[model samples]
Target: MDTTQTAVKLILDRWEASMHNYDVLLQSLSDDQLQKEASPGKNRGVYLLGHLIAVHDSMFPLLNFGEKQYPELTKIFIESPDKAVAELPSVQELRTIWSKQRTSLKEKVDQLKAEDWFGRHTAVSEEDFAKEPHRNKLNIILTRTTHLAYHTGQMIYLK
Candidate 1:
């Protein structure tokens, strides 16, 4: 394949591996431990998990695949700080959503053509995208992979 195709493939491969590691880390947690803070003032495992889910949910809309699967997640996980909101979704509920959303997102990503990975995402205007093509769907995957890795580290503190 061409350079773009090769690069996109590598990105997807890394993304899949990163997600697998995240899943293993999450599966290791107990429900009781999920409620504890990662650090004194930091977010809990449940909150971080929800936040990651919400961010991934946004990928559908952001990458032009479809609307977000969990808009409500934005309010509790993205918009509000941990414990700042009176209540958040139950850990079981978020885990269900996370599993479903990950499968859906993987299917969507798998369906993309090599060229599609370099196409501008939903956030960019046509004119701007034409000028700044580097900000593409693959960029989001790379950024969000780093994000998941960061939170995965925090999750260890909760254990």
Candidate 2:
């Protein structure tokens, strides 16, 4: 009901729509076709989707000062052709994770204070000190959401 919640809800709505569009686009391809590389150098639709899911997981851990965690999306390697291929999540699995993450983000962002939104970090300058840190708001939804939409365009256009 408040401004933060409203903004968070809008981000969640956009993300949810992206899931539907991505799912529909993938569903159109045959199994073999889905596995086919969109380009010789580029990752397949499944890989792209996995990466997107991993990005969502990244956001939570990134909010911490310094930490790393393996995302369930792409913890396994698939190189050399002899190593076993990592399995993609089932469609239902993808939907469930995406839905849960969006809901969590919506709640977290709403509860976060204005100071939390305004983040401080050191500037990349010799003169800048710990005390002279730069500030930025965690207001990147429009830009990053646009990135997802752009990647979707690539998925839709791939042969």
Candidate 3:
């Protein structure tokens, strides 16, 4: 494999491992535990879970795989503050959504070719993206990896 191919494989492999770890951690949480905040005046585990799902759902359109399935998630988790909402999806509900979303996303990512990983992502014009080839689908995976790790740390407080 070439350097770019090797790098893409490494990123995807590591991302898959991280996501697996996150799934394990999330599944271990109790409903009571998920309600507790990591810190005072901060988001709870349930909010964090929903927010992560919302972000992942957005990746569909952002990466040109498909339209977002959960646009309402943006209103609840992205646009609104953690505690601003009177109601959010329960842990069980979020778990069901997350499971389906993750499975679909993994299938899409697995379908990508090495060249597809390097293709222009959403919003970047073909001309501009050709000039800045590093701004591609793999970059989105890298960014989301960091996001997953950050939220994983907060969820750790639930344990």
Candidate 4:
């Protein structure tokens, strides 16, 4: 309708497209294939999947949606590199978590008004937000959309 609404729609559309592309790519791979490295000595498909989930889970707190659903994943998937942790969640387990997390996140995101996207996220101080208005909740979506696309490109090598 308005310029702000159009802009928000564009950003969200890109995020959803990136997510859809990732889902299709991941679904095409089998468990055995996911376990293999995306490239020699690089992260595996499963590792990338977990890493994405961990990053997205953090958005809950950053966006003031709530506490992270899987804070433990931050240690295994974000703090440590692939294979750094002796034990990792099964591929199926990660898939289930990913689905649930995305579903809940979508519900919350859908409830937001267009103006809400321009509000300061929890991570930014009010003083700073006043000075730097671009650092808003919608910016997180833009950044994470590109982040997802980046990993999705890497995972393509696993196919």
Per-residue CA lDDT of model 4 for 1-159, tens digit only, reads 999999999999899889889889888989898999988999999999999999999999988999999999999999999999999999999988988998898888888889999999999999999999999999999999999999999999987
lDDT of each: 0.92, 0.55, 0.91, 0.93
Task: Report the CA-based lDDT of candidate 2 relative to the real structure.
Answer: 0.55
lDDT of 1 by residue, 1-159 (tens): 989899999999999999999999899999899999999988989999999999999999999889999998899889898888988889999889999999999999999999989888999998998899888899999999899889988998877
Candidate numbers sorted by lDDT from highest down = 4, 1, 3, 2
Candidate 2 wrong stretches, greater than 4 Å: 1-36, 39-41, 64-70, 74-84, 121-143
TM-scores of the models, in the given order?
A: 0.97, 0.54, 0.95, 0.98
Q: Candidates 3 and 4: which is better by lDDT?
A: 4
User: What lDDT score goes with residue 45 in model 3?
Assistant: 94
Instruction: State each candidate's clash count.
Output: 0, 0, 0, 0
Query: Candidate 2's residue-wise lDDT over 38-93, tens digit each?
Result: 66766666565555666655555544422223354546322212124545665455
Residue 121, model 1: Cα distance from true site in angstroms: 0.2
How does candidate 1 score on lDDT?
A: 0.92
Q: For residue 15, give model 2's deviation from the true position in Å.
A: 7.5
Give model 3's TM-score versus the native structure.
0.95
